[model samples]
Target: MAALEPERAKLDTTIPNESRIADYFLGGKDNFAADRAAAEHALTIAPELPALSREGRRFLRRAVRFLAGEAGIRQFVDIGCGLPTQGNVHEIAHSVAPDARVVYVDHDPMTVVHGQALLQDNERTVVIEADARDPAALLTHPGLTSVIDLDRPVAILLFAVLHCVPDDDLATHIVTHLRKAIAPGSYLALSHPVSDLCPEKTAKLAAVYQAQGTITGGRRGNLRTKAEVERFFDGLDLVEPGVVYTPLWRPGEETPHRPDATWVVGGVGRKPRRPREHPALT
Candidate 1:
């Protein structure tokens, strides 16, 4: 537990942390009064916030399963991973392939503390504290590099995290770095809140996050249009039904149907292998 002091120092009971607020939305016990209050405030602006959070988790589960089962990905770098919750990346991935390795990265210190505790016994998973916006540093972090080999096919999970990376240019840089690092056939699965879904309400939600302040290590939140979100998948081949609303992305029969207003768009895209060059005219 000595290693947790750094993250513990950053904890403030007065201001709600994004990860803790998200934990509250997911009905997890890892939150404080400030988080609950913030979530309640968000509800007044967008009553479906809780449901949207759940739908986001469902999309994450489905995306991870698809990567592990169908895409044959054995290693994962899940950036901006929040607090440990039910059906986490390792659990979902391991269910499909027991040998899969996962490294969970987050900027929130508490998330790293809790995540580390959650996966301590699981040899296949490790949690590290790092900002997702700096893909270069995160991708090269010793904790992540120790578990995932960049030369091999890997899946980078950005689910529900990109919106927290406010700067569009910085976001593009993050994706570009990731794209350049991963081997061909790697995947990027992301879910971002879109403005087009419910512009007025979503704007209010963004305002709520902005007012909450960035007590954590990253941006509060930023709602992007569906087109803006789609651009994150620029160099990859989007899977079927690309960048659709969360529940609409390859939902299983059991996945509950959510209203279109939920507005969080998600998709999984694979980096295709570059074609080999032919020999010069011989």
Candidate 2:
């Protein structure tokens, strides 16, 4: 049988897309041959890639639920949102708050195209093609503001996406930029792969991604330690159980176990109502 066309989206199926690779990791069938190859290549080194990806998704679900239900947030902006799959940010948020609005942003054209098609009928949500590195542009997009009100408390989600920004300075700038742009009481929830638990494995995994391309796109490893990853949340007030292993962040029912099981670390930070000058969350 021949390979099927990428629906109507003009996607370069030849090159491995980060979203497609993540889709493959999440056991989805929307990936191309290139994505499977890249994923298989990484699997040889880190067999836990799939598990790590699923754990990261779990963290996203938990965080979004918290923001919508417990945190009383009504607007959500999910940057670097990959392929639209089950239990997306909008779905999770809507479950808790029917009136909650969500804006899903992804630089990948394929993701944007596919998400737009999938969400065309969902009035409360909209997906836009935008780069996460430029938070100001995306945050200010009419498409985002159409659904999200930046004036009030909105949750900005960066789940399993920041590691793609290998440049330390640029990564910090992105977070800081977003922190500055959002109004007071807004929240930033992020989950990043950490190297503190398994330095050797994580480094090799980073090299695998670094070899693949400029953006080491993966949620399992990025060669940064817990401390380094924590810098992204600087200045903002971290919520309870700040920056811990994914499973330990807010695990349901079951007792959280080994940190190595979930090498990825996650946390949710909020901007105070009266910042002593509105510092950047660098």
RMSD of each: 5.4, 5.6
Instruction: Give candidate 2's TM-score.
Output: 0.91
C-alpha TM-score for every candidate: 0.90, 0.91
**lDDT of each residue in 72-147, candidate 1, tens digit only:** 9999989888999988999999999999999998887788999888778988899998776556778889998889
Which residue pairs overlap in candidate 1's backbone?
none
Highest lDDT scorer: 2
Top of the candidates by TM-score: 2
Clashes of each: 0, 0
Residue clash pairs of candidate 2? none
lDDT per residue, candidate 2, 109-151, as tens digits? 8899889999999999999977776667888889998888788
TM accuracy, model 1: 0.90
